[model samples]
Target: MKSGCQWRMMPKDFPPWQTVYDHFSRWNKAGVWECALDKLNERYRHSKKRAVPSYAIIDSQSVKTVYASEERGIDGGKKIKGRKRHIIVDTVGNLLHVSVHRANINDTKTGVAVFERAAEKYPSIKAFSGDAGYRGTAVTFVEERLKLKLNISTKIKDVFAVLPIRWLVERTFAWLNGFRRLAKYVEILTATAENMIRIAMVRLTLAKLP
Candidate 1:
């Protein structure tokens, strides 16, 4: 598909299709894709019409990887070879931050990175919502470092209090899955995998424009 696009568009001066594909392949390996996503998110924040986010949602999803090595480790939860995508989404389901880690990495560990990064990037973010997996140190880190509040959604009598807002983050995950690349894991390197995710998000932001 990429080769065909290059052939039709450039026709005469185009570099070899394999070379172009190789560049993208290499960029993914080096984590350029994820960096691109970060830049896009930065741009989005600067140009956004809404006021700063008062809250965000946090969660992790498991994606299956075909090339599993001793380095990546095993995921007992999914029972498949893969990695975890830890993401933070805003009240409107817009992605604010993300981290990719080995499937075996605990959700709480990745949660720290996600919140810290988000706090650094968007200082106005004041609160976060998530499940019990984010209960202990995860809650403390956000409070101590980010100086933000934590709102955990549990099966309590006050479920109604949390349901409306918490769903935004879940909806964001569903929106991200709309991109087929995210639906299946294909990248060889973690950086490249993150780049695809960033691209999907940038595309989403652009789509929302008038």
Candidate 2:
């Protein structure tokens, strides 16, 4: 899946396309991918001298879906028809939580889901940061329900200056983009797409280890 080639286009040296897909589907359903990601993430955290993240950052990206599916919608702002990936990352850019929804969903609405998912897993997470898009009701919802500080970093005067704190999540997104399959939301199922991200994180965490 990482190769970005169509399953039917898989090379002869690889396992039969159907065989490979069956394993992928089965593992996704069994939550093996998420478990692997959590273990690898713990290793990466220890490598950086941290036990768990004290705070997290949230962000979303809209990508165009390749096939017609009920999981897609039009992102009027980006003008793309597909889905939005709402992801929360730690200070060092490790993924903490990820949720997918129709691109048309507002950031504030999905922000709640992302924070709740992270809060459930990481009790140490006391705060999170995001761009102006996460301000207003989203900020209030997270703070009230999840009891996490929501920092809204406004744009700076310089056109090219990177925003503080929030940039970490953006870098993580870039890291995920390195996996060609994630360059677009091609998976027919939302869970499969999310599992693909976990697989990419597993590869990243392993690569960072000596």
Tell me the TM-score of each prediction against the true structure. 0.76, 0.95
What candidate 1 gets wrong by more than 4 Å, as runs, is 1-15, 22-48, 68-71, 156-162
- Residue range 66-90, candidate 1, lDDT tens digits: 5742226567977756788888888
**By TM-score, how accurate is candidate 2?**
0.95
* Cα lDDT for residue 188, candidate 1: 65
Residue range 1-210, candidate 2, lDDT tens digits? 468888899999989999998998999999999888888888888988999899898889998897665589999999999999988889877888888878998898788778787888999988888888888888998888887788888878858788888888888888888889998887888888888888888888788875
Which candidate leads the pack in lDDT? 2
The lowest-lDDT stretch of 10 consecutive residues in candidate 1 is 1-10
Best by TM-score: 2
Clash-forming residue pairs, model 1:
33-195, 34-195
Estimate the overall C-alpha local distance difference test score of candidate 1.
0.73
Residue 116 of candidate 1: its Cα lDDT?
A: 88
